[model samples]
Target chain A: MTSKSTSPRRRQQPPIALVILAVAGIAVFIVPLIGLLARTPWRDLPALLTSDVVVDALRISFIASIGATAISAVLGVPLAWLLARVEFPGRSIVRGLVVLPLVLPPVVGGAALLFALGRRGIIGGPLHQMTGLVLPFSIWGVVIAATFVAMPFLVITVEGALRNLDPRFEGAAATLGAGRWTVLRRVTLPMIGPSLAAGLALAWARALGEFGATITFAGNLQGRTQTLPLAVFVALETDRGAAVALSLIMVVISLTVLIVLRERWWRPL
Target chain B: MNPLAGLDAHLVVSRGDEFTLDIRLRVPRGKTVALLGPNGAGKSTVVAALAGLLPLEQGHIALDGRTLDDPDDGVLVPAEERGVGVVFQDYVLFPHLTVVDNVAFGLRSRNVKRGPSTAEAKRWLERFGIADLAGRKPGDLSGGQAQRVALARALITDPDLLLLDEPLAALDATTRVDLRRTLTDHLAQFSGPRMVITHDPTEAFLLADEIHVIENGAITQVGTPDDIRLRPRTPYIADLAGSNLFIGTAHEGTVTVGDHQISVADRHIDGPVLAAVNPRAIVISLAEPGGSSRNSWNTRVERIEHYGDRVRLQTGAPLPLTAEITPAALDDLRIAEGSPVWVSIKATEISVERD
Candidate 1:
């Protein structure tokens, strides 16, 4: 039945080298996961994950990642709409700056954020003096750093969706006496729901896996600012078993998110 | 001057360096005016301008004694405040909403309570005879059903002006006839100014009270159906009106069109039908010629018009039709206005289709 369903031309065997390389590509991702599984201490996994350092890291990771995702959504959606719809001078420059964090090294982004918002830095000096507050080496710094590195994912996804949407749907709504806000809330946003979901998932995953920016900007304080990746980094130097356990947790989370969102990310909306 | 009662607008908009639309339109209360033009003839531009989706670069638009857009005076009412209900091409219904929610959207946007809006929307669905489809999404509807939903959504807002852009251009031929009748009934019920934008000459002639012939961003002629049909000002309108359309009841192989009866080639069609006869298919002779043709009549020439290499004779009497003949044939027959002529058409030449 399979042979009858597929055309004869499509049933032809692919080239040998192409097949070999495709298998190699699959193996490249699978090999490291297999290695991690081989090294996992399954019986001691629950005890290691429940330790104080691990528990604190888990709480901090959840707070920082979810908080960053919320912030990104609030600020990035409107920024994306502006870039997609409005025509302004230097608009391309603003778009390039939004996308810079994606391709730039995370460490570089952390440094840039530090220079802008550090205690003694340009705006940070006045901010600290006026409010008697500091941002670096705190949980707030972790969220900021994560957002700086992860928000581009959401902005780019939503911008592309907005650009591809038919403007006539919004026009129809407006002609129906819907105000601008109502049209955006009712028509434009719902029509781009799939892409927005995909963008949020991608951004959350990126924030969960963040290491360099968090460690560089927020510092590695075990109970205050240390997150999962920072905990892994600290454990790698002192205890290899805890490091492996943390890595396994991250692997499980990332895999589950990807499996759930595979269709949205890989296919055209 | 007395305040205008309905829509009164002069639209002038320039897009870049290549195209500029400049036209004036006046649709009185309780009248349907059609802006008829072919593709790229600025039909969409007119729709957009009237719906307040695009601002006029120059000129004023006044509806029911109120000014909507006047560029020189810096008065521009945004689309949301224009009180215009538009059924866009292809309907453009929100895919995420159910039929009830889609209908209720206009009321919801006006700050109406959810319970009242839903009840009102359901009543409208019942009025349109689609109450059972209230729970279904737009993607699940047929083309005709979707058009009804679009109409309901637009009309629920109770706007002062209703605009339909190619309302039936998306449906199949069989569905179009039924939907056109439904649309005609709906248009009659709306007592506000209504405008229909279409490229189909038959739709414009049948649906609108006044026809505005637009070409190259300008209106060339404005008149009633018969005036536009018989005294076309441009070659484009001449070409469009050249085909004669007759709606009649068919029995066996014969169709009764108004006062005259004509034989059609399709013997199996036995209901109301639309028959089309091209001007070229009609043969004109000075005397009654005997041939295999089944339909021939003695008629007087009411008008004679020449359109580039061809002469069209507007015949009067028992059957009125325009027949195209070469300039040489006109010289040979020496036929002029008020001349008696014999018109004959083979039954096979008349194309008949279900109305």
Candidate 2:
């Protein structure tokens, strides 16, 4: 019989078992990161880093990711607000569909993007016929592809934040002589600023690392369409060291920005 | 400017098989009324309807002589155009904006540019004694500070009707009591109609000139605080009535119950009447012979609950009664559950009314 007076002894795991479990998780993630750092050619690193192709890929990645982020904010934030606040028919279905990209493979998402925005696509055909512009293998196409894949990240983040916010704040804004558009611009947007930043960061990361959709739709060119991820993928076929080095740069940039973001804004209330 | 200065609402709301707010009330300019109710008494519904957040099922809402909502006339003012300020239950402060920015939000919406809006916000913050904390976000402030900011933001636009929905329920007891006076001062300074919803009688009494008690979705009584606290009709009302009331048959000068003839303070044509007595009014003694109090009975103590300064004795005789006594009296008499004691009350202490 167990009594309240006597202290309970903790069950211990075997040293071997603990070591094995830790090794499994580490080998999948930490080991690969260590491999990248170790395999980096310190002698050829400077020459490879100074290359114009690498510089252009980095520039394209930054510009496209930022463009995707801004576009997502303009479109996705409102969509998120609508999803959270509006009470219309098929709302539950719309919410489920908004999070659909998160569970899907990026490559399959690229293929679906191709079918929709291809020359003969429903709306794409009209645009191509009227304006003599086919978006395939273009920088703008890369942005569209990255946006389609990354926007859901922003939408989901903002939607969750909006759902948690009390609806009364909107009412308070309305009573203060604010119209619908004004409440969205002044009150609702500022209130969810942190969630918006978090959403932007995630979307930027997703857009920057986009290899499948960009290559599939925009067809990884030398400088125009080739982002850092596409450059790394192309380099993998020729020089493995160069591929690792490109990935390391992307990793360093993302990790540094993420650290800064967390320090400035994600503190516990 | 919004023309909702004096809101007169003939409100009708029904949900499911029960609950309705089919009552009419008018809030005059420059006065405060409290909506007091239990948990699900549709108190918030009234505020929501007035604010135009919830579409009313029926009735007419006219503010400042302009119709806001009239289902019969197809008149409904949009929530954005209603111009009825609200301080929500959770404070609902914009988590991202600083105190100044959150306050400025209202003025900014009124087409006053940023420079003027923030100046007005700063002025309001100074009035609330929170100008020093104006740069800080809502997440940085304490509960009391946040609530003041919410009130300030709601009032900054000088709205016609201000609705506060359980604004102090989120506060600690000490802070709640202290904030009541500050809120009262603010309400007095404002010249618009105000409605405050609260479940606490103490809060309602402190803030409201007129009190409306809602029970099971209907306005059961609307009166002064004294009236609601003393002359409660329903059980929910009696719960707030402070004094304990019991219904019993009156025979001659005595009332028969559980094999005992109990004397009543009430006289003249009496079949049944509710005996009202304050728990503090009854005196408990150890002696069985009782006293010259005119109404005394041999009672068996059922239970004893110790309050901070006093003890409530729930005793059983012909009728079960609860009496509040000081701890010293309880200690001296050694009062405990199942003890045989004599309970006495002055005839003047008891008041009887028809049930």
Candidate 3:
């Protein structure tokens, strides 16, 4: 057994400081979750979760998050490809701007979205005058807010993956009589399938957890803009049990997705 | 053979540094040209330029009288439309796709239906004897299997020009030998203009009908492998051709090389000349032998390389020489590194050409 210990696969002890900090990190991450689980009204869990307000919020959150993920996939994938492969003037600036929403406070992003698409706002003013359409305080607006904050997760993840992929594959495809579109659809996308899945999962989770932007831009209209996090926030003041149940639901969903994705795709090969 | 003629290109590619490739090449129908050069000698650049991956800074590429690239004429065919199939240095088989799917990609891109495309891809796999592994991804295939698949994929396109970039460089030595024969056979069957980029002279000789020696971004010489090997134009090619070359002034039959005067058989060029002597031509002796061999120099052995069956000795200057002798000769002469020895060469054995 000791002789087998000489093999390279034998695990080495981590540094004491790293071990301490890692344990501390895990404790901080899980402690709130433990508290939420402990405080959950198990007997009343089914009834509380099935309440009209909670169910409606959950439904809205699902629709909005799924919509956001769809939008991100449609727009963010091409943007990621562009950032990873193309070289142009202002490319670095464009890349920095893509990640701005990720670092920018959600409230600020909401405010920016408002200024751009709000009534009597910059683009919104013209849009209203031309089409008489108002985007704010709508389900579409909630999706837009979640997308603004969440698409960056997908974009950055996919971009990093695209950057790491060998561009030679694309070259090989092209030389094999594959057009740009064919190569993108057939070669480039398929090669980065895992990263795409991971990015979608991450973006979906972020959209599901979105609060400040949704509340600010889409307003707190129940069943319309009030998603899971918004519902949790509102319930915390009046119904702690409902809030805990809602929070637990959100946690379970996002954690389940991330865990399954980690096991299937995200783990280092 | 196909109706498509061949490739004719005069390419000028200037990249970041002052490294510019200004070379002209031609690959006739039913012939393969091996672009031989060391790394950074623009071998891959030439392949890319021909395949339309890299745009020409100046000049034009024409295949079968059709202009592929002409910067002056504002004509540049994109890589996809160029009809040039490439087997990249790494073979670059799409890792995500099954073996058959990877082969069918080119056909599918050309708008062939899935049924016919899969059937055609299967045909190629059968040719490569990997039809059983059609469902397997490229990652699961061994290097040799992957190379054959790459060739099959490229050939299925029925391209006007086929480019193989160091096709066998990634395989292990034994696999390389086996695949080299397979590649040579495939090249014979594919009656299109082909170009193979390789740094190994032996690979160039074995796989290609013609050899183009490229060095420092320019084609130094182009000829049959024997022509290039026997009369190598550059020091790099000389080394790659496995010969020791000396550049000096030749007067009458005597050539002065770095203060050492050696006699050559031909009084061909009087001025600056290149003299190439194969390592097998030079003979080493424990003492200077008085004979008709006109060239003799006393030098110390600098290094001894065990080259499988034979030992190659690197003797010290005033005329630094590399000589291959039998191990029995080495043992009989009691030669080791740093041993003083006399090397002799017949004047007729050295080939002289104008520098």
Candidate 4:
């Protein structure tokens, strides 16, 4: 009865907005969402969704982003562990380098990926000469570009989680006759499981939205290398209505993934 | 069977220029040895060195006729392979694992597969009376429950040596006393040589068959609990062993200090010396002690602290002296600080040694 009586008063709360502008300081973010929703074309949405180019780009985008996120967890986690745990000369420089891609413009990262993995590039030349293989303008190039740009998010997140964990747990595992690998697998990873999940989600989201690097490296090929963002970019140049429909689909998929993630893995539905 | 036969270690670990631990310690098989020291006296360093967690610049460690660490000879086993179990100051239970899984961890690491190792973990959890909490994580356990889980975790492997680093320091006073006896009984039944480091004398005396008083990274004194109580070498050890320590002089059978010539027993020096006598040895009376008493002094009472069955009376006289007496004695004499009292000790009770 007391709670019921308090509900109306809660609904009639005062306008304390400008009185406290600190919380409302980030209101600029909502303008984009408002603009996106308003400009998204509702008519001809079904025809746009049924387009063969749209379907193939969507499939490639999902596959490449998920693969990049998987690769990030495998390689980035151990590197994060090393950055967090071990001490050596140039450690600070190595840690700084891990976050380089976070600040590097996506197009610059694409150029960097091309120089390193292009057909005549350092390790790329030997691979091309020996196996007649190259990563440039291919589905694999999209993965490389996404991984390059998205790995910093996974590494930094997992590293922060590792730093916050009480190191005594690892010591306890050591005294229990477990070696370093066993301790990492059984104790350290499980202890940071929440952070791992959160980091993977963030990295996957970042990869899914990758455009500059994927287009520069993979050349927006339909059904082969083009991702959803690339498809949306091409549609924006040619057909504005179709561009809005593709963008709405991207928004829906991202929103659904985020909502499901929050409900299932994060907040425990 | 003796799990460890006479573990001997001479460990030297230096952190900074000022912090150094160079001490040798020994624990016989199936005996509980207490490493008694004050805070920051390198007791934990000794434990860490023995557990092989810290590297020693100069040391030789042998357990049960096996060479575990000897830096001079280049033989050092890391902590995991040394087969030494440790209960750290904070218990160090894995917060992500269940109580049972934490206990079963050691067995599983030794390649004893899941079902049997978990059965062993269950038995240990039952032994510590925490079987119902087996499925719960370490974060869900209370202090006492976590301590028991840590104990079960440390003991499941049945390591060669069991080292406890201030196991009860984290608990409340009441929990400490209760757990002290429980831990003591469990340790008494432990087959391996056990070592515990603590600053509490009562804890040391209760759990230790023999006690070693450590000061400034060296073993200052080593003896049974009674021996330490009777003759403590340093001020901290003296206070811990319930003895009043003072600096005085002895010539023949008389000690002179501050214009007071007190008669004592078996004196060889006429200059400065360390004089220690048990607080329980001094008797307090309402008047001057009668004739034939070797030493008697009129002193003003300073302070008093109740220690379980005994009352520790601090007094200022010819020397700062602490006396131990029964509560009954306290009531009979009406002992209070600022009250003039007569303190007398037999010549034989006072033990004097050159510092």
**Candidate 4 residues B229-337, lDDT tens each?**
6545565676788865555677887877668776777766566655668888898898998887868888888877676676777777577677888899899998687
> lDDT tens digits, residues A1-269, model 4?
23656445544555688546855566666777788788876777788788887889888998899989999999999999999888989989998998898888888888877777789788778889999988978888989889988889899989988998888778778878889899899989988887888788889999999988887777788888889899888888898877787788888888888897885456521
> Which whole-number lDDT from 0 to 100 does residue A185 have in model 1?
97
- Compare the candidates by TM-score and give the number of the best one: 1
Q: Which regions of candidate 1 are displaced past 4 Å?
A: A1-10, A263-269, B1-3
How would you encode candidate 3's per-residue C-alpha lDDT over A1-269 as one tens digit per residue?
A: 44555557866678999999999999998999889999999999999989988999998999999999999999999999889888989999999999998889999888888999999789988998999888889898899999999999999989999998898888889888888889889988888888898899889989988988888888998888899999998999989999999998988887888778888778732
Q: List the residue pairs that clash in candidate 1.
A: none
lDDT of 3 at A170: 89
Q: Which one wins by DockQ: 1 or 4?
A: 1
- Top candidate on lDDT is 1
**Rank order (by DockQ, best first):** 1, 3, 2, 4
Interface RMSD of each: 0.6, 1.6, 0.7, 1.0
Model 4 residue B282 distance off true place after TM-score fit, in angstroms: 9.3
List chain A TM-scores, every candidate, in order.
0.95, 0.88, 0.92, 0.86
lDDT of 4 at B303: 78
Q: Residue A254 in candidate 3 has what lDDT?
A: 76
Q: Is candidate 3 or candidate 4 better by TM-score?
A: 3
Model 3 over residues B277-324: C-alpha lDDT tens digits?
888899999988797988888899987867557777777888877787
Assess chain B of each prediction and give its TM-score: 0.97, 0.69, 0.71, 0.70
Best model per DockQ: 1
